[model samples]
Target chain A: MAKKILIKKASGEKEIFSIIKLKKSMMSSGVASGVAKRVISQIRPKIKPGTTTAQIHRLAFDLLKSEDKSYAARYNLKKAIMRLGPDGFPFEKYFAALLEEQGYETKTNVIVRGKCISHEVDVIAEKYEKNIHAIIEAKFHSHGGGKTGSKDALYTYARFLDIKEAWNIKKNKGAKPREATLQSWLVTNTKVTGEVKIYCGCVGIKAIGWDYASEGDNLQELIENRGLYPITVLISLNHQQVRDLLHHNIVLCKQLINQDTLLSRLGFHGRQIQQLYQEINKLFGS
Target chain B: MAKKILIKKASGEKEIFSIIKLKKSMMSSGVASGVAKRVISQIRPKIKPGTTTAQIHRLAFDLLKSEDKSYAARYNLKKAIMRLGPDGFPFEKYFAALLEEQGYETKTNVIVRGKCISHEVDVIAEKYEKNIHAIIEAKFHSHGGGKTGSKDALYTYARFLDIKEAWNIKKNKGAKPREATLQSWLVTNTKVTGEVKIYCGCVGIKAIGWDYASEGDNLQELIENRGLYPITVLISLNHQQVRDLLHHNIVLCKQLINQDTLLSRLGFHGRQIQQLYQEINKLFGS
Candidate 1:
């Protein structure tokens, strides 16, 4: 009998390596199914008994990079997002900005009174024209193996009900009943479970996760469609550089590429600034 | 001019020592004005420039102990309460027990929904016959200098309004309007500002503090009247021992005096257990 080949997970647990799982992930990045199968087959023979999932990811990433750089960038989205935080504030800032681009006035780290208590809302977005207001809970996973599960959806739903009750009371007190509409969304940098998706849908709570959107508009699709790639996704930038960019609220790659002054303001010298610009163009422009 | 005597505060700041303030505090502890004045005069010559307020407190405490040990115990009430925590959980437990003694069914750390939001109430007490429900917020100050201020009063008022709104909504939905009456109380282990008392009184929110009381029933008065003293008041036991006792829910000194099995359960051996028993009797019996 052949010895079982295992891959070490981010959590230090080991699992049997699956070529199908690797192929599905690559396919999600818009890589052709044939290309994904070819990449996984080529990488499979190179996997050692003690090889880590990170090592396997690197192997697949390199193969995709050599074949097609844009696909490799898209494939690296989850890993790049995982690097965004030791804290969730940066992701909340990025999510707020994404909402802003969609014609909503956005606020992050807001304390709003609920019907029974006060809550520190992560991101709040409002569109006056559409009479739409959304309270968003942004969950950022700092590790590849982490997930936003069903419990998070349930908790978000409870919080939403509280906020919705406050809105209803306020409306009845002075404003028209239909003057404004309130909604709650749970946005995560990692994928959510199928159970979470089902629960959220049943409760009318919108959930946006990496590759786990209800209407084919996941976090990656939303960002890529708007050219609002986070600065953390830049190939040339290190984690520290990305963190510094996030600290200055320069979250989007487009925000950095459009402003030379902003780059200088971040204390980046001429050579480093030039490299960042070139990398941004190559990754985003193509 | 004579050099002014300074006293160190719990916040590590120094202020001019005031005899009038000392007298007022002692009077609040049930010390007669004449006795308080005599105690101050005896300690006056002993107080030196740069002497810490803690030292002055010790001098007065010794004088009170010699004159009347019960008054000394009452005077030490604030310090004993401060020893209840590095966190406020123990104080909440004690407060819940205190409410139970007052003929109210009590629940601690309860999540109750209001008309506008959900509130995690620290202590909820209900007198079934009277249909009176009181939501109590227990503010434990680990340091003597800490205070429950006007801002706390304002926040508590807002929470009260939310809970009251929920009650009204529930009453309108199905229950009779007079089925239940709701009230909110702020209970703290330190002094509250006059502003807080005034604001609370104006809004019908009950404010209870170590010395500040809305209806002449401060925390000390309530505990002393009911003979419900927290085990943290025992000078014989160290902070860790008090914390361990509180961990097992052995809050009152009276409870410790009655339970031999409970003491052994807390890992207290012969000598230490005897000392605790003796100290409890000396403090409570006098």
Candidate 2:
């Protein structure tokens, strides 16, 4: 029998190491499949019997950084987005901006009356050309260990049903009837359970989570393809500094690179501002 | 072997029914040991092979109501307090009032600085006569099925440690220090896990919940002895009505009983107000 190598998780649980899982994660960061396999093989030999997952991640990240710095940053997407919150407002705003980049007009914190009650939607995306409207429930986990589960999916689906019923009622009442197709999409900054994925599939609701994707457009793809990295992704700033930036709605690193005065407005002074600029350039520079 | 009878739980899981558990629940409602045993014996035969715990609760509630209406209300105390919240603000206010009734000067939503951070305490009680100060973290679950777990207890203790450290620092700095003992209490409207109870006992942090008590003064004893029933206890009002009342800080039934205009201010119509008055009189009348 092959030796069972264990990888320690952040939560102190241990699981058997899987090279396949590692390769898939690398490929999701936009690395070519061939390079992903090569990188995995290179790191596999270095993995000891009881290697921590964090150490393995560091090894893979170093290789990816050497190969392509941007891809390395993209690989760290989950952790970066997590730093945007103790509250999920920043994540919602960033998600809206990502949708906006894809030619969708987006509104955050939109409240609409459902049949029995009012629903506060995290992000509402409208594609006028396609006449497509999506009420998005953005479930953000502030820490990496937390997974969005079936309970959240059930809650989101129920809300969608209510709003859909309300919409039909309004149409029948001849209150601003329009030819837009409405659908519900659950978006999260972390992975979701297999149960949630299956539930969404059965119900015709869309789910976009860290690793769970539909139509090849998961959160990782949406973020990396647009190069819209949150400001927390930068290694230069501390946790409090990142939180301060998020509080000011200065979400993306590209926003910081483009707007010089933004840092001063957020009360970043002297050496801190200079340090942040250097880190941004190093991470985002080709 | 005695026949195994299953009792369905709130979360839809079923377990073998234990008469001991049922008897304990009855005794916690202030029923005498002999009467509790009699009630248990009476209901034992009525319980079918696979009856739900909720059905058993209803049976006991009916029996208690017939025996003594106030005891019935006290039996429903946990559920009533849960109805006081979709948010915990109302419970905090009610808790503060309960402390006041015990001759303690109380404040809610008090923010005090810690060693490294600031903590927003749910309730702070100070008995000036005894020179005792207690910081309370009141965890209010909006549903009966929810539990206060070790995680919350741990978090509360950590916060208390931080504040205690800050307090020591202040005392050392000659910040007008008085010699008053500081202690932490974790109070909840739901039952806590055994792990939490054990942890609290070991650490000298007081844990008080619906059924979980320290030194015999559990949530049930406190509320019943003081006659501080939250307005949510009234069966006459719907969930939304209870929520609205809580939102306006009309927590206690006595508040509504005392002020006739309060119900009108809360937008309760003539018939609904009359119904509320009748229910209040039935529950709290001398």
Candidate 3:
């Protein structure tokens, strides 16, 4: 099979540029040298057959750790609600686990659902009282920065997220009411287009172009200053546990209510029982 | 299996509220009754057993939609990210899909990771612009709302996020360039302690107790807004396609540099290619 181009332009005018120069412009020129140094270790002369992408990511994470440079993959949300097991593409989770080894307390899998609907919020982090945090959207494609065959693929994802976020807010009654806020982001080693700007606008999400050339915060700093928190309820907030809490509370309430109902069914016959019932009523209220 | 209980004794005696009162205070009063009133098709005493959680969520979404109420399950960030396919949670992706029939988008399995480090950001929407436009962090834990647990959990998340925003400003060279400029937020279903006044220190972020009971925009609306461009990017001045326009210029530079590199490698030795060499050099220089 022939190697596929990561980016392919159709009839529309297409242009290609040097990865180094592109990085220099987007990121400060000084940062490019550091990024290049880091990339040197990640890039292999040849790939070993049958290596899973997860393994490659793990290698990258490990390399960054050894160098003491921060890695983006290390910090993630808590894994309390809707926890993804090893089978899932928990690249950030795995990265976070490595950060934990460094004695950093990172939260994993924060469950941020749409308030109107139960949509997942991926991951979240916080400083002290302030909420200057970052949300990450991971993409796991077969090819690394390969050309996306579908037109407006990234845009579709962005729009979908925008709509989903809206639905979540209007639903979950017990959820904390937030404002119309979200700094939409896309984290993919995929090629995008100029049209993405308009498409993203149509919804309200941003398509962050994260390819080999792109450089973000390293894992150490991410883990050191910011804790990792995944967006899954199972992971971050422990939805199952919360559900259990709710269930436990409900069961206790039912028991109390049932006792009251039973006493009423019994027709308040005994004086002592009636006194006890009255006390229970006062405790539980009408 | 039996559930575990987490309780901590205070240094001194503290007032304990009745559990029933707590439940009533938190329960959805008018909404549930309204939903029950509209669904007169078949009044079953009990919901069916062995039904998947997703199915239950779908039913809830349907009921909410009928009442003009939103469904929280639909806005899950995880579900939206899953639309990208491999990067999302398998169970959530499918479960959210089931909710779609009821006009509710099942957003699930959103993969969010922090860019650097922070405590309070729920989701970092867009990362293209120099400054972070919005950061959202959620607080949902089973025991977090308890007497001791409630006070510290959210406060810690909030404080961490605020610090992160400040740190990001320093790292990213935000205006004023203090170790504090990145804004963030703290969103929780529960309220924070008044005594923990440290949350007041959150410079650019807001500590919000999502008080579902009160009326305001929820987390979903905030996320959707972040998806929108210009606003999401925090461009010093708004530009429709800030990234593309900037990237186009970068691409032009790359083309010029690539032309130069090619010219250097050609060696000017080939007779046939030599005639074009002078023209190429002049073109690259300019």
Among these predicted structures, which one has the highest TM-score? 1
Rank order (by lDDT, best first): 1, 2, 3
Clash pairs for candidate 1: A114-B116, A114-B117, A115-B116, A115-B117, A116-B116, A116-B117, B115-B166
Interface RMSD of 1: 11.3
TM-score of 2: 0.49
Per-model lDDT: 0.79, 0.78, 0.34
Fnat measured on candidate 1: 0.00
Q: Residue A257: error of model 2 in Å?
A: 39
The top-ranked prediction according to DockQ is 1
> Which residue window of length 10 is worst by lDDT in model 1 chain B?
B150-159
Across residues A156-211, which tens digit of lDDT does each residue of candidate 3 receive?
A: 34233433455454535444334323344444334544444343443344444422
lDDT by residue for model 2 (A144-202), tens: 66788765766677567767888988887886537776888999988888867776776
Q: What is the DockQ of each candidate?
A: 0.06, 0.02, 0.01
The clash count for each model shown is 7, 0, 131
Candidate 2 lDDT, B1-286, residue by residue in tens? 6688988887678899999898888777667687777677789999876798888988888887677655577677777787676789888998887888789999899988766456689999998778788999999888667788755765676567767878888877876436876889999988888867776775678998986797668887788877788876676778777777777777787878755577777778888887778667766645
Candidate 2 ranges beyond 4 A from true positions: A1-286, B1-4, B11-46, B59-72, B269-274
Candidate 1, B164: how far from true, in Å?
A: 10
What's model 1's lDDT at B23? Answer: 95
Per-residue lDDT, model 3, residue B256, is 27
Q: How does model 1 score on DockQ?
A: 0.06
lDDT score at residue B104, model 1, on the 0-100 scale: 86
Answer with 2 or 3, whichever has the higher TM-score.
Answer: 2
